[model samples]
Target chain A: MEMKKTILNPEGLHARPAGQLAKVATSFKSKIEVIFNQKTVNAKSAMSLMTLGIIQSSEVIIKADGPDAEEAIQKIATLIDNHFSV
Target chain B: MSLKIIGQKAAPGMVHGPIFIFKKGNSEINRSHHLFSDFDPSKETLLFEKALYKSLQDLENLKNKFTSIDKEKIDIIEVHQSLIDDPEVKEQTLAKINHENKFAYVAYEEVISLFKNMFSEIEDSYLKQRVLDLEDISNRVLFYIINPELNFSYFSYSQLNDSRPSIIISEDLTPSDILGFEKTKVLGFVLSKGSPQSHSSILARSMEIPCLVGAHELETLDLSKYTDLILDTENSEVILNPNINEVKSFEEKVSLFKFKQKQLFSFKGKKTETKMGKLVPLGANISGPLDIDSVIKNDAEFIGLYRTEFLFLDRITPPSEEEQYETYRTVFQYLGHKRIIIRTLDIGGDKEAPYIRIQKEENPFLGVRGIRLCLKEIELFKTQLRAILRASNFCNDLGIMFPMVSTISEIKEAKKIFNTVKTELEQSKIQIGKKINIGVMMEVPSLAWILKEVSDEVTFISIGTNDLFQYSNACDRMNNQLQTISSPTHEGFQRFLKFIVQEAKKNQLHVGVCGSIAHHPEIMPYLISIGVDELSMTAQNILTVRAQIADL
Candidate 1:
């Protein structure tokens, strides 16, 4: 399952948001990956998510594979859509 | 060639010394495969977790240390805590140790480096600054993994010798790091990273150490090669490997600074008088009894403004009447005949106390503070008054002053409370002093207009120029962005001062000027000419102001 979301935060996906995304990815038994600027990184790894340099207004593709892939995609998509306020 | 690196001047002073590069954490890690050869994968992962736990504990301790004193510093420490708890960084480090069979330190370094590189590449300057946070966390984890046996002291003050003063060159200094070093031994600070508003920078300023922040090129410099360097905060430049002429000029300035100090010291015992032999009473503004020695040493005639709020701040509860009485008694006993004017509790606004329970306001500077806070908390005000009255029994020359009185009714109300306290003390058979002068700090603009009305009620008036300038200019003195407009020397402010002095003289009231503007060499002569009967400032400036007055 795959979902596309725009980075809405004025600060973009910095350390804080990257940590949030990574935390959400680890909760589900699925291999989650975030694709930005033709580069795909493990959504479960903050260092990898950060390396993609996903910035404000940038489009990102979140892909999840395994039994809970659909749920994983939805959770992460909601986070990015909500601009990681929590 | 003398290379000049520019940065924001965090503190003011000039000094030349050998550069001491103090990087936080152990950056030099042995990446050799030997350390990782016998590494049990699960054991290595466990070691990494343990290091993270230790780092988190250290950060928490640091946060607690600064929690009461500085809120901004506590926020910085909290950021580090969150960075350490980031699940991705932890998982990646564990994966490297488990899957790649790398040492814990090496794995941590790789992950930190990856994040650092990514942060550095970000075009946004604010986001790019996060690289420092990443580096700080990585260093802490690596330090634990490499030297588990060695305990780390956040401030490595014991390692440096007192005999050899050095300029600390670092990527960034945490407030804890700056606090650890002896102010005397650390002559200056040169940072590769730090904003002017950083707590470290604020600490440096309070310590009076020359500091230059945001010197990006300092991180790349071969500090070992350049043994001697000049940190000139006045010019906001750091000169590395200065030539003969540069060294000569720097030494000349140091000698001049020393000579000026000596010159000022020569006038310490002499009466503060003009060349024409007109004596002007010079005094020191003290925060507490601790500054009594400085007041005597500086030969100040009296304690002009004893700020009493220090006792109420940084505490869980307001000081009791007995506690306040003891402190006031100590000051009065020490000063003896040297009259100490104690300003009643002036907390609120910038000097907020958590225990005081003031509502958060959009413009706290103009909010319920000083006498206004006291007016609302009547019991607290009465307790302080009773204490002051009790302390007055110890000495003859105790002057009581009310702060932040803008209207005649406020003075009338304060005086009513004062009379009630005095009557209560007398009724209790307390041996109060025969004559205690009552005064008001002339800070509010409205008070200046009604000086004639106030002069009848108060025995003396002390113009607190710090707030007067801020109030008159409608600028927040503490706000760095308003530096240009917040000056005390504005023509309008000068006119206000002149008018107040004139009105004070017409009403036959002893008017003195106290604040930063009081002892300023250039401002002193002008104030004297404008009929300011006395000037009070920090004890350190008494000698300087005396010398300046003598010259006039």
Candidate 2:
């Protein structure tokens, strides 16, 4: 599996919803890399997302490769598409 | 095999409606960024005025809705409206639109940003909601301003074919959304945002709805796939996409819950006493008159603590003594002279009071707050005292409590003001409750340690556990690192209670807990066992507290 970047438009990965996305992304037996701007980071990192201070209309790219690549992409993409609001 | 459900259960009823997620989509407008950049200054000014007019009109509509109280909910709209009308907010909007010659959308964005920063900085959850409510309203206002013709309808669960909603999942819910929903038809509420402290959670507690917040994998839920679901607020877990047996058990539990509620409500108007013959005077702490009806329904022994701070905060100045007096009189009259203990201005520390400015100390927990500030600012204290006293004659059982009393001198100073207010009311030839019971809080261990001495001066003592525990352990309960440090079940705290209990007995004075611990069920039994004379807690827990006491 190859990693690709996507732009994040919704203001900051705020509160715990960001951490939640990270947690869900890491739950699967997959290697996920979430790159935000110039900083490349792990998708499973709460601290990383918190430090990024990703504001609304910012962009982030999520790339994952695993046995369940389809499940990983589908779930992560759905989570992001929901504006990471939930 | 199941879709996930996560939300704060707002009101308890089962609904099987299709999931209609209320996304609050942005209302699109015809104006483009390029068009706005090229627009004439005169046109921009007109646009700003138009948007401002719409905002003001919406605010007026909100005022009528919140103030013209038809049902139970408080006029929280008034609180938000005050924020909207705040000088700081107004100045910011004026600067952004008129001075900067910015687009109406940019001006709105700047205003929202200002609110988000201001509200997020404050410590209290209830007050924080004040900011969030303002933000929500501002967002809605912006949405309408952008597209006046936009059709906006967002409900997490819709009643299709007139069936009850099965489960509602959301990121978070506004206070209005929770109140407007058909509570009886909603089975479970799960949210991506908010928890026990959020507005939705508080309402859910009020309605006894099964609510869960900060749950895992809610966004992953495809609720339409589920035929059977279980929404349990107590557990903060929703069992979705369940099998037949799980559904049967949940339905049985619903019936059982109804039976239990019947048993609970039967004791509604009756006194809450234990089987062991302990006179546990159950009183509800109220902040508003709307709460008085609940006190009546719950058969509250008395209004333990009437928080007067809510009236004082946010506004440019404190409410007029007449306004405060009238408000107090209404609640006191409604309760029919029941023992209503009015705690005077327990602001500062974590609570943000813009009117009464205090120097920002290094540690607010150890700063001059509560009684200290009240004593230092005698005029503020006198106004509040006079309001309570004027309402005193209207209600006979008017009691007063001074919070954050760390020493006897603080009580003495507070009492001196109390006496002055009493004499002033009398000297003015206004009839008042001459012999009112004045009490001091045992939040500081030093006060608890010397309760025997000060206990004689005041008629009674109320312990504020949230602060006491924090001070005793030298830990901030809100600090994630020290979260484990707080627990009443811990010995240092249990020992503290034991000391206070024995001290109250020694003084032959009454003792009650007006803290968060008063409602903690795990601590309640231990509290009763430890000689806590009276337990004053949240209104929602009063019934359950009574139930547990009955079980005892």
The prediction achieving the highest TM-score against the true structure is: 2
Docking class of 2: incorrect
Q: Candidate 1 lDDT, tens digit per residue, B1-552?
A: 678898888877899998887765443543354354687888778778888888888888766665332434555676677778767788888889888988888788898887787768855544565676676667667767765645445324555544488998888887657755766778899998887755577677655678999999877777778877999887889999899999999999989988998888888777889999998989899976656666887889888999998777643346656557777777777785777788998977666465466888887779988899999999889989998888888777878899999998999999999999999988989988767989999999888888889988998999999988888888878899988877777788888899999999999889998879997767778899999999989988888888778879
Candidate 1 chain B, which ten residues in sequence have the lowest lDDT sum? B25-34
**lDDT of each prediction vs. the true structure?**
0.80, 0.67
Clashing pairs in 1: none
List candidate 1 segments past 4 Å from native: A1-86, B1-12, B23-159, B170-186, B189-226, B233-237, B240-246, B288-297, B308-337, B347-367, B379-396, B419-435, B469-499, B520-523
lDDT of 2 by residue, B1-552 (tens): 644455544443442223434454444434464353664555655654555556556545544644322222354443334334343444566577667877666776777775566446644343355556765556655655465544222222243215655456667877656655666666556676776656566667556556667765766665456555566654445666666676677778778877877787877766778897777888888886657657877778887888888677554345656557778777767874678788888887556554566887788778888898888778778988998888888777767889888887788888888888888878899988645788877788777778777866888888888888888888788888865666666887888788888989899878888888888878888888888888887676688788888888
Q: List candidate 2 segments past 4 Å from native.
A: A1-86, B3-18, B23-163, B166-230, B243-256, B272-278, B286-294, B307-330, B347-367, B377-380, B390-394, B423-435, B465-508, B515-532, B541-552
Docking class of 1: incorrect
